[model samples]
Target: MEQSLYPVEFLHFGIHLKFELTETGIFLKICVVNFSVLGLFFHRPLALNLKAQPGENVTLSCQAPDGVDIEWSRTDLEELQYVFLYRDGHIDSDYQHQSFKNRVELKDKEMKNGNLSVILKNVKEEDSGTYECRFKAAGEGRRKRAFIKTKPISTIQLEVADPDPGELSGCRLNLNSLTGFYFMLEADPEQTLCVD
Candidate 1:
């Protein structure tokens, strides 16, 4: 009599295994290789830069899907500061920082259209920093209940510049000039002279 062997392949949970079957019985060869791991995915965050003058209102835009729990935080600070937090179809102000209190607002009506942006009123020099927008999909569970895992969707770098005095006088000053120029003239004692 003659004996023959056949090769068999099996794949389970991203792991590949091979086996050999003969006329007498079955033989097991443990060959395990993983191509992908469960729950290990990559997500690239979007970058946004914004510049505004002092006392100006700025809106930090974060485009995410509708009905997701969104949170805005200042990551450039010494400690992670919560700017705004929206969850369960409402804004949670208890976790917001004192500096951002009563100054942040969300476009509640626009959330239906996937606009998770927040408006920061009266931007100050202190507000210039890197802000991160994170989102947590509904029904998503983390490995630990104490550790709330969220995914970063967007990052915004804000810059606030002082208002130019010449701009208030309806004069367009060339700010690119490296050399400062001065003008002197004989005027009344009550007159004042200002140099930018």
Candidate 2:
């Protein structure tokens, strides 16, 4: 014969619950608690932030106190694609974008700390945009958008030249970097590289 035992009594500071069992081994119980006390135990969940730099890797992480569902997507597209998703401390699907299929990876697949971080490798200039990370708890949901930009680069050039010594030795002087104009120490303003 099979038997099942369950709680049968629920009691509060001022109230009480009772439990009973039958010959078949079936048991039941009741629970009672102060409304204020239950409310005090309830708490708001924490959210995760995502960030990245261009030509570098970016991770959009979503964390929940109780392993809530997490979804990632881009906002500009008419049809949203699921970059990745997590729930109950596990990856839900293998679905991913073609451009990101091989380059994308998940850091905390175990969801040990409710962390769902999606890492994108070798970010490109086109990837400089916004990303969305959403979390769903029961029937409630919240979302966050992160903007990514490209890293800074330095560009420089150098050149050497030799002009006619006869043209450079006279009183006339030339400054070629900013423009093709020239100036003379003893010449009038009109004679100094004037258009007329």
lDDT of each: 0.66, 0.45
**Candidate 1 residue pairs in clash (backbone atoms < 3 Å):** none
Candidate 2 global lDDT: 0.45
**Which lDDT tens digits does candidate 2 get at residues 56-81?**
66665444433355665554433435
Q: Give lDDT: candidate 2, residue 158.
A: 11
The alpha-carbon deviation from the true structure for residue 130 of candidate 2, after best TM-score superposition, in angstroms, is 1.2
Worst 10 residues of 2 by lDDT: 150-159
Model 1 residue 174 lDDT score = 39
Question: What is the Å distance of residue 150 in model 1 from its true position?
Answer: 3.6
Best by lDDT: 1
Q: What would the TM-scores of all predictions be?
A: 0.56, 0.40
TM-score for candidate 1, residues paired by index: 0.56
